[model samples]
Structures are given as structure tokens and as C-alpha cells.
Target chain A: MKILVCISKTPDTTAKISFTDNDTKFNESGVQFIINPYDEWYALVRAIELKEKDPSTIIHLVHVGPAENDAIIRKALALGGDEAFRINSHPGDDYYVAGQIVNLAKEQHYDLIFTGKETIDYNGSSVGGMIAEFLELPYISLATKFELNGNTATITREIEGGEEVDEAALPIVVSCQKGMAEQRIPNMRGIMSARTKPLKAIEPVAIDPLTSISSFELPAPKQGVKMIPADNPEELVRLLHEEAKVF
Target chain B: MSVLVFLDQAEGHVKKSSFEAASFAAKIAEQTGTEANGIVLGEVKDDLQSLGKYGIKKIYHAADAQLNQFDDEIYTALIADTVKSSGSNVVVLSNNFNGKAIAPRLSVRLKSGLISGAVGLPDTSNGFKVKKSVFSGKAFANVEIKTDIKIITLNANAFKVTEGSGTATIENITTQIPRRKVNVREVNVVKGEVPLAEAELVVSGGRGLKGPENWGIVTDLAKALGAATACSRPVSDSGWRPHHEHVGQTGLTIAPNMYFAIGISGAIQHLAGVNRSKTIVVINKDPEAPFFKAADYGIVGDAFEVVPKITEAVKKLKGQK
Candidate 1:
């Protein structure tokens, strides 16, 4: 069985976010980037687990970004992947990114495709469903737990206030979230061997972005704190009613 | 250009977020000089006409029993078909679980421009530009969609629901529930006083409370204020709280009216999840916790002493009211 895991690099969780070029582009000066946790922790780790269980399962990692993302791809390869492919282009929208991936995955026809639920940077959880839609396969989003037996994949998806268990045949697409797998760190041997793993940069396909960003603005500045004495807990409730009117 | 809203349901009742979607659709329809309509799949128990209060002029409900269970593919096809028949050029849905699953597929099926988690109404002067939360609610962006058929999934509580005197007539639509591909086995529901995402009032805890045994300090306050309970990542990772309760970049990002943090030293990631809140209150022993910088109110005290006093004060205030 062949598995294709889509990965992306996002600003580190602790990285301070500031925009550039009048907020039309994200500022990258001195910003640290890492494999999106959802991709590295949930999607890729689960694929590695499947490969560990069945040695015949071949896992491949795919990324759609410029050359800077190659470092992130090598890190993903360090986790557990036969090869990594980077589509060297910056997509202005999620659909275009999905279009590039769909083009690549279509030729491979892998039995299973995996992606993080959403990138922490954009928080637009659309790529998985868009890929499945273009591919015309069953797409499950925000999968918390996934299991495979024979050709059937049973998935537990996180819904509004609960979770629902579902099953679909192979050649399916899944977007993973927190409970799908645990986080793994690359060790010395894994990092050293990752350098020798195959990392290919492919030419990009032409797809127009459906949407364009005009500008970005920071949320309104917060009102500084109003300190209250610990002994005056009652004053907090009174202020909640009179001053804030929140309660 | 007609506007259509997908009123998502759970346990045969339309969700509150769907109403917010309705108001949003109404805003677009009013702007475009069109009528706002709605569609509901499965067995919905609410009076369909009452949705008119939210400004929908008509409702197309497909009451097929099989449609009750969420199959995004089937629902996508159905919504696409309804859009074709109704001659609607715009679609609106709450950017919650169901909308997140369907919007992307529907966009591809209809070949339309899609916006997920829109926080502002579209500015249609030159082209259709909508403001959306980005970078996990830390920043906002104005995005332009150039497609004729546009799909928008609204963030929870982004638009306020306003009731008009109009009552929308129900139009029953016939849709074929195709052979199911994703078989649903069982559902595990967590019953809370308020759904965490939509809660206007929230009380969140961090690992400083120690363990699950000491969660009473957090819950006791939340129960008194009738607020939802949330946790920082470490607390959820330690298994002291459920993963859904984790309110950070990786968990659920929420924007409540009042956010009370206990024992949490706000990390940048954790702040990204909740910085959109209207007001924030932080209570902790350490005076230098980062959350205090973001909070509207701060009380430097131990959680054990501070939370109980606040809970009692809230209960006393409610009783007096």
C-alpha cells in the first residue's frame, strides 16, 4: 500500500507574527518555521505507525512551497518516508495548492492520502476536502482516530459537540487532528540519515488563485488590565455588571 | 443573485450557529438586492417558518431520514443541486464542523470561490471582498473572491442574529440520498451547559491547579457564572482535561465575551486561540504571568482562594438579581 502525506511549514508556535509589504505578505525576517504540528504530529506520525506495522507500506511526503520549505521536507523525511516531493511554488489560495497536490496524487493513485486538519498559519482547513473533491474520493476531515483492516478504513471524526465513527474503502483522503497520533522528535541517527533520503523538487502546474489577499490588519489593541485587590473579589462581580456589562 | 444558507442540524434540531449563518446571508442578500433563503437536511424539529425571524424568506428542507447523518459528499451534492434549482449565486454556512467539511467540496463541485471562517460582511463595491480571521485570530485579512458563485462559512458568533417580522414559507425539496460511502457507527456526545465554541462566557484553567482532583476550583467558578470550561494545552495533554477543552493554537480557538483564566501563564500560542475575546480576566498567583498583559482585568492571588470567592460572589449577585 502506498501512502501520500501532504506537509507544510508554518511559523513556529512561539514565533511573533508581523506582516510585510503593507500586510499583503507575511514578514519572514528572523521568523522561525517548523513542520506544522498537525502535519508532523498527527498525519505523518500515523503514517509512520502504519509503516511500522506493515513493512510493505511505502510512505511519501509532499509539500507545495518554494526552496525554503526543502528544509522542512527533509525534516519530515527524517520521521519516516521513502521519498519527498516539493512542488516549488507559492499558492495564493488553498484551492490552487490543492490543485497542485491533486495533479501529483492523481498520477500516483495512492490508496491512502493524509493531511493535517489545517495549517496553523492560515487556519483554513480546506485542502483535504478540496483534494478529495477534485479526486472524487471520500474525504474525511478532522479525524481523531483512524484504523485500517483489509480495505476498509474506519475513522472517528470530531464534529460539533461530539464524535462520529465512519468507514470508507481505501483510496480515501483524511485530515487529521490531535488524537490521531502522538508527537515524535527526530533523533541523531534519523537526522543524519535524512540527508541521504531522496528529496525532489518538481515544476509547478499553472492554476489561477480563486481568491487574493488585499491586506492584513492586526486585531484591535487590547485594553490594558484593571488590577483589583485579591481581597475585593466582590468588586470584580460588581465591575463585571457595571463597567464591563459582560456577566 | 439569490443568497442561500445551509442550516446544519444535530439530533434533528438546527444549530444556533445556523441562525447566525442566516443573518449573514440576509446581510449579503440585502446588499445585493436579492432574497435570502435557507436549506436544511434531515429531520429538523424546529418550526421552519420561525427561521424567517433571522431574515430568510424561504426554507428548502430535505427531510429524508438518511440525510440526518452527516455524509459531506452527499450533502455537498444536495446543496449544489439546490443552488442550481433555486438560481442562487451565493451560499452561507457556519464555519463549524459540518460547514468545514462541506464548503471546500461544494466550492470544487460548483467551481466557485470559497471563504472559510469569514468574520466580516462582504464589501461589494469594486469586487467581493470579505474580512476574515487569519493566523489563528491574531490578525485579520481582507480577501477578494473573483468568482460569480461565492461560498462563505461564517465564524461562530461573528454576526448577531436579529429577528424580523417576516416568516419564511417552507419549500420541500426532493433529493436523492445516494449510496452511503462513509458508514457512521456511533456518536459520542459531550453534554455541556454551553457549547465551548459559542459560549459567550468561558473559564479556562492551566496545569498550575495540579491535577483533575483540583479542577473543582475552575468548574465551580464556571458553574456559578453559567460559563463553559476550557483548559490550556498542558492540562489537556496531561489528561487532566479533555482535549476539546484545550483553548490554544492547536486546540479550539474561541472568542468569548468574557474569558477567565486561572493558573495559566499565557503562551503566545495559547493567546492566539482566544485573543479575539471581547474581554479577558486573568487570576493567578504569579503577578508576572503573560496572560495578565492580554487580560482586561487581573487579580494576583492563588486560584484556590480567588476562584471560590469569585464563584460565591457571582452566586450571591445572581440570587439578588
Candidate 2:
């Protein structure tokens, strides 16, 4: 089985998000970039699990970014991926990113493609589905548990209210969420082997971006906390009804 | 110039978010001097004509059994083909799982500008600016769509469902159904009084509930109020509740009208998921819990005592109403 895992290099969760150059681009000054936690913890881990279960399975990591993202690609290799490919271009928008991924996946004819539900920075959650459509394949999002038998793969996802079970074929895309697997740190031996793994960089096919980010800004700070007497439940109700009008 | 709305349904029923999407599209149609039409992929048990109450002039049904289950590839292609046939300049969908999957796909196929998680109508007076949440509900961003075909996926429960009376015409459309490579073998449904995502009111508990044995109080209150049940990530990880019911940044994001959090400390991740709730009520024995800072109503009392009393009050009030 050929498994393709899409990874994105994003600022660490604690990094302060800011913009530079008249608010047109993300400012990366003094910010540390890491493989998106969701991709590393869930999607990549699960793909490695499948590879472990079957040695014949191959796990390849793909990213849409510039050469600066190679270190993160090497980290993913250190974690578990057998090989890595970096598309030599910054993803201008969600459409361009999805198009690049779809083009690559189609060229490779991967049996299964895995991605996190959404990237931490963009939080778009649209690339996996877009690729699925471009390839004319089934897609399951936010899958917590997945099982494969022959050509069919059964996935369990949490819907708005309850749990729903769905099945798809081998040539499908799945966006993984939590509970798929526990996060793993690379061991010494694994890190040593990752240094020898092949990390290839390839140029992205030309594609026009349909969208652009005009600006970026931080959210307003929350209002100061208001404390109420602990013993007075009626006061709380009154505040809700009269002041907040939310009841 | 008609507005086409994708009405997502599951198991022969329309989803709650679909109604919100329909109403949103109808408002847009009214603004643009066009009529609103809905497209359904599979068989639905509800009366298609009754959807006219939301200002839909007609409903298009592609009644293929294969579409009864969600197949993104087929759904995207069908929607793209429908837009072309109907000549719809504007497309609307609910920013739920189905919409999230198909919207971007449609955008790429149609070469249209797409905005997901829209909270309000676009500012048509200006080019085409749609307001959407950014940074995990921390802020808002106004995005402009430059393309002729504009697609907006409204957030679930963001728009109100308007009630009115009208008889919509139901038309059966014929289209070639794309072959799906995926196959569904079995479905495992979780049985409970309320579904977490669709519930207007939710009652959630955390590790402060002590143990799984004491969970009856939370469940009883949820039953009395006809609300969905949820747990903080800690509770779910501790095996007190299924992971599906976990609500947080790393978990499920929900926007119910009323959210009752009991014995839970509001972590930033948890707050990210539920901050969009219209009203938040927190009940905890600790007076200094962070949840109280964000709660519209806070009861600093023991859940063991406060939950039962609240349940009794809800039962009594519901009987009266």
C-alpha cells in the first residue's frame, strides 16, 4: 500500500501571531516552526501504524512550502515516514495548496492519503476534501478510528450529536482528529536512522491562486473578569437576565 | 440569477444546519433580486414542499440511493453540474462536516471564490465582503470574493431559521451519478437522549464530577431538559465518557444556544470550542474557577446538590410550559 501523508510547517501553538509588511504577510521573525501538532500526532502517527502493521506499506510525507520547511520535513522523517517530498513554493492560498497536493497525489497514484482535519495556522480544513474532489475519490473527515480490509476502509467519526460509522475504498482521503493515536516522540535510534532517510525537494506545478490574504490581526483582549459573591445564586440569575440578557 | 443552496441530509432526514443555510440563502436572494432554490442529493423523509417556508421557490431532488450516504466526490461533481445548469451565481451551504468537505472542492471545480464559516450575510454594497471568524473564534475577518461565482458556507446555528408558509414546487432532475469507489459495510450508531451537535442546549461535566458513578446527575439533568451531554477532554480521557462527547479545541466545536458547564475549569482549548454559545451557565463548587470568568451565569455550589435542584426546577418549569 502506498500511503501519502500531507504535513504543514506552522508556528508552534504558543507562537504569537503577527503580520509584517503593511499586514500583508505573516511575520516569522524569531518564531519557531514545528510540524503541525495535529498532523504529527494523529495523521502521521496513524500512517506509521499502518506501515508497521504491514511492512510492504510505504509512508511518504509531502508538504507545500519553501526550502526553509526542510527541517520540519526531516523531523517528520525522524518520527516515522520512510521518505519525504517538499514542494518548493509557499502556499499562497487554500486553493493553490489543495491544487498542488491533488496534482502530486494524482501523479503518484497513492492508495490512501492522510491529512489533519485542519492546519493550526490557516484552520481551513478544506484541502483534504478539495484533493478528494480533484481525484474523484471518497473523503472522510475527522476520523477517529480507521480499519482497512482488502480494498475497503471503515472509519468512525463523531458527528454533531453522536458517532457515525462510514466505509470507503483504498483510494480515499481521510482527515484525522484526536483519538486516532497517541503522540509519539522520536527515540535515539529512530533519530539516527532519520538522518540517513531520503528527503527530496521538487518544484510545484504552476497554478494561479484564486485568493489572497489582505491582512492579519490579533483578536481583541477579553474584558476584565467580573467576580460575584459565591453564595448568591439569585444574583447570578439576575445578572444573566438583566445585565447580560442572555437567559 | 438564482441562489442555489445545498441542503445536506442524513439517513433520510434533513440536518438542522441545512435549514439555517436555506434561510440564509433566501435572505441573499431577496437582496440580489433573485429566487432561492435548494438541491437535495438523496431521498429525504420530510416534505420537500414544506421547505418553502424558508423562502425557497423550488427544490431539486436527485433521488439516487447511492447518494443517501455522503460521497464527497459525487456530491461535489453533482453540485458543480447543478450550478452550471441553474446558472446560479451564488451558492450557500452550512459550514458543517458535509459542507466543509464539498465547498472547497466546488470552489476549485468552479474556479469560484469561497469563504467558509461565514457568520453573517455578505456586504453586497461593497465588492463582496463576507465576515468570518479567525484564530479559532478569537477574532473576525472580512474576506472579499473577487470571482463571479461566490460560495459562502454559513456557520451552523449562526443564522436564525425563519418560519413562514408557502408551497414550493418539487422538481426531479436527472443527472448521471458518478461511480463511488468507497463502500460502507456497517454503521455503529451511538444511542442517547440527545445528540451533541444538533442540540440547542447542552449540559457538560468535567472531572469535578468525581467519578463515573456520579454521572447519573448530569445525565438526569440532560434528560429533563432534552439537552445533549458532553464532557471536558479530561473526563473523556479518564474514560468517564466516550471521546466523541469531548468538547474543546482539540475536540468537537459546538455552538448551542445554551451551554451548562458543571464542575469544569474552563481551559483555553475548551473555551475555544464553546465561546460561540449564546449563553453559558457554569456551576462549580470552586469560586475561583476560570469558567466563571466567561460564564454569563455562575452558581458556585456543589454539583451534587446544585445539579439535582436545577433538574427539579427544569422539570417543573417544562411541565408548566
Candidate 3:
């Protein structure tokens, strides 16, 4: 089975977020980039775990970005991906990005595709469903647990106030979340092996962005805390009611 | 020609976030000189006509028993058909679990432009533009949608719901259930618990709480404030709490009226999920904790002592009310 996992390059979790050009663009200077945890920890790890169980399974990591994202993709390759591909394109809106991925995946015709439930930077959980819709396949979002037996797969996802277990055949798409798989660290041997793996770059198809960003504004700074005496917890409640009116 | 809202419901009751979505759609419709209608896919027991208080002129309910449980493919297909028949060019939904699962698929089915996580209404003076939070609540982006058909999902609690003096007409629409490629075997529902998605207030703890045995401190505060309970990623990772209760970038992203974070050190991932909250209160023993910088309120103290005292104070206040 050939499985494809889509990866995204995002700023490290601890990186300080700042904008440039009058808040019209993200500042990339002095920022560290890493593989998006959702893709690295859950989606990619789960795909590698599936490949480990079945020798015939080949895992391919796909990223849609410029050349700067190659390093991040290589890190995913070191983690256990058999090969990697970079769709040479700019990361535009979700629709444009999904269209690029769909065009590529349609040609490969992989049995299963996996993606992070949402990118940490964008926090827009729309790509997986859009890919599924464009491809006309079954898509499952926010799957926490997945098990495969033969060609059928059983997956569990959290709903509004409950958990749901669903079964689907092969050739499906799943957006993985936490609990799907544990984070994997690359060992010395895996790092050495990754150097010999093939990394291919494919040109992206031209697609117009349906949405354009006009500007970006940072969140308002928080106000100073209201200090109440440790001995006067009742005053905190009073402040919450009379001053804040929250409770 | 009109705006259509997708009212998400669970157990026959309308979700609070859906009310926000309805009001958002109504406001947009008013701006465009159009009527606002709603479509619900479930066996809802709530009074459908009463939804008119949110400015909905009519409500179309697809009372299919199978829809009681959400199936995104089925919902996408049915809602797409409904949108076509209803002649609604604009669609609105709350960016909750159900809306997140279905909006993108529906957008593709209808070949419409979609803007998820919308924070502000459209600026229609020069075409259609909407504001949304990007970079995980660190920044906002104003996007212009050019497609003839537009689907928008409002972020939870981003808009205020207002009531109007009107009544809505209810209509029942029949839709064919799509072939089930994915079969739902069982549903384990969490009962008697406030769902974190729409909770106005949240009280969360982290590994600093020591262990699961001491979880009462967190729950007590949540109960007193009538809020939901959540946990940091480390708390859930170590099996101290269920995965569903995990609140972070990798877990659940929530925007509540008030977020009371106790014992958490304010990691960026954790902040990404709850930073959109209107107000944040951080309590920890370390005065140098990063959370204090972003919190509207800060307290430096031991959890064991400070939590119980706060809980008692809340109880006392509620008793007076």
C-alpha cells in the first residue's frame, strides 16, 4: 500500500510571533521553523507506524511550499518517510493549497492520505475536507485513534460531547490529531539513512487564490492584573461579579 | 439571493454557538437587503419558530433520524442540495466541530468560496471582504471572497447574539440519505458535563496540580463558576486526564468569555487554543511565569490554598445571588 502524508512547515511553538511591512506580512527574521507538530507527531508518525507493521507499505511525505521548506521536509524524511516530494509553490490560501495537493495526489492515486487536522499557523481545518471533496472520497477529520485490518479501517473521533467510532474501506483520507500516535525522534541511523533517500521537486499547477489577505493586525495587549490579598479571596469573587461581570 | 444559516444541534437542542451564527447571518442579510433562513439537519426538539428572535424569517428542518448523529458526507450533500433549492447565495455556520467537518466539503460541492474562522462581518462596500484570526490568534487577516457563492464559518463567541421581535415560519424539507461509506458503530456520549465548545467560561489545570487525585481543585472552581474543565497537553499526555479534555494547539481550540488557567506555565501551544478568550486569569506560584504577561488577571500563590479559597468565595457569591 502506498500512503501519502502531507506536511507543513511552521514556526516553532516557542518562537515569538512578529509581523513586518506595517503588519502586512509575517516576520521571518530570527525565527526558527519546524515541522508542524500535528503533521510530525500524529499524521506522519501514524503513517510510519502503519508502514512498520506491513513491509509492503511505502510512506511518502508531501509538502507544498518554496525551497525553504525542504529542510523541514528532510527532517520528516529522517523520522521514517521512505521518500519525499515538494510541490514547488507558494503557500497561499487553503483552497489554492488544497487544489495543488489534490492535483498531485490524483495522479499518484495513493490508497490512503493523511494530514494534520489543522496547521498550527493558519488554524484553518479546511484543507483535508476540500481535498476529499475535490477527489470525491471519504474524509474523516480530527480522528484520535485509527486501526487497520486488511483493507478496512476503524477510526474514532471526538464530537461535540461524545466519541464516535466509524469504519471505512481503503482509499480514504484522515486528518489526525493527538492520541493517534506518539512523537518520534530521529536516531543516528535514521538520520544517516535519510541522507540517501530521494527528494523530488514537482512544479505546481497554476491556480488563482479565491481569498486575498488585505492586512494583519496583532491582538490587543493585555491589561495589568488586579492584585487582591491572598488572605482576601472573597474580594476576588466580588471583583469578578461587580467589576468583570463574568460569573 | 438570501442568507442561509446552518444551525447545529445535539440531542435535539440548539447549540449556543449556532445562535451566534444565526445572528451573524441575519446581520449580513440585513446589510445586503435580503432575508435570512436557517436549515437544521437533525431530529431537534427545540422550538424552531422561536429562532426568529435572531432575525430568521424561516427555518427548514431535515428531520431525518439518521442525522441525529453527524456524518459529514451526508450533511454536505444534503446541505448543498438545500442551498441550491433555497437560492441562498450566502451560507453561514459556526466554526464548531460539526461546521468544521462539513463546511469545506460543502464549499467544494457547491464550488463556492469559503472563509473559516471568520471574526467580523463582511465589508461589502467594495465587494465582499471578511476578517478572520490568523497565525493562531496572534494576528488577524482581512480576506476578500470573489466567488458568487460564499460559505462562511464564524468563530465561536466572536459575535454577539441579539434578539428581535419577530416569529419564524418552520418548513420541513426531505432529502435522500447518501450511501454510507462510513458506518458509525457506537457513540459514547459524555452526559451531565458542560461541553467545552460553547462554554462561556473555562477553568483549566496543568501538571502543576501534581496528580489526578488532586483534580478536585480544578473541578471545584469550574463548578462554582459554572464553567467547563480543561487541561494542558502535558496533563493529558501523562494520562492524568482524558484526551477530550486536552486544550491546546494539538487538542481543542476554544474562545470563551473567561479563561481561568491555573498551574499552567503558558506555553505558546496552550495559549494558541485559548488566547482568543475575551478575558484570561492566570494563577501560579512562579511570578516569572510567561502567562502573566498575557493574562488580564494574575495571582501568584499555591494552588492547594488559593483554589479552595476562590471556590468558597464563588460559592458565597452565588448564595447571595
On DockQ, the candidate that comes out on top is 1
Candidate 1 lDDT tens digits, B229-254:
99999999999998878888999989
**Where does model 3 exceed 4 Å of error?**
none
How good is the docking of model 3, by CAPRI class? Answer: medium
lDDT of 1 by residue, A1-247 (tens): 9999999899988887889997888898998999999999999999999999999999989999999788899999888898989998986698899999998998888999999999988888999999999998999899989999989999999887678899899989999999999999988888998999999899889988888889888988876899999999889889987899998
Candidate 3 local lDDT, B1-321, one digit each (tens): 999999988889988999999999999999999999999988988999999999999999999898987888888988888899999999999998779889989878887888899998999999898998777776788778888989999998899998998799999988778887888898888887888877899999998899999999999989888899999999999999998898877788888999999899998888978898988888898888888888877778898899899998898878833
What is candidate 3's local distance difference test score?
0.88
lDDT tens digits, residue span A1-247, model 2: 9999999987765565567787656778988898987799999999999888988999989999988888899888888988888889988777888888887887789999999988776667888877877787778887888888887788987565555678776788999988888889999888898889988888898988765555555555546444455545445545544675533
- Clash pairs (backbone) in predicted model 1: none
TM-score of chain A for candidate 3?
0.98
**Per-residue accuracy of model 2 over B1-321 as CA lDDT, tens digit each:** 899999999888888889999999999999989999999999889998999999999998998887898777788889999899999999999888778878988998898878888878988896887877655654456677888999989986789998679778998988889787656555566666676765788899998999989999999888877788999989998889988788876677777888889899997778767878887888888888988888777777888977776776666645733
Give lDDT per model, in order: 0.91, 0.82, 0.88
Order of the predicted models by lDDT, top scorer first: 1, 3, 2
Query: What's the true lDDT of residue B159 in model 2?
Result: 90
The runs of at least 3 residues in candidate 2 whose Cα sits more than 4 Å from the true structure, single-residue gaps closed, are A14-32, A216-247
Tell me how candidate 1 scores on lDDT. 0.91
Off by over 4 Å in 1: none
RMSD of each: 1.3, 2.7, 1.5
For residue B194, model 2's alpha carbon misses the true position, in angstroms, by 2.8
Measured by TM-score, the strongest candidate is: 1
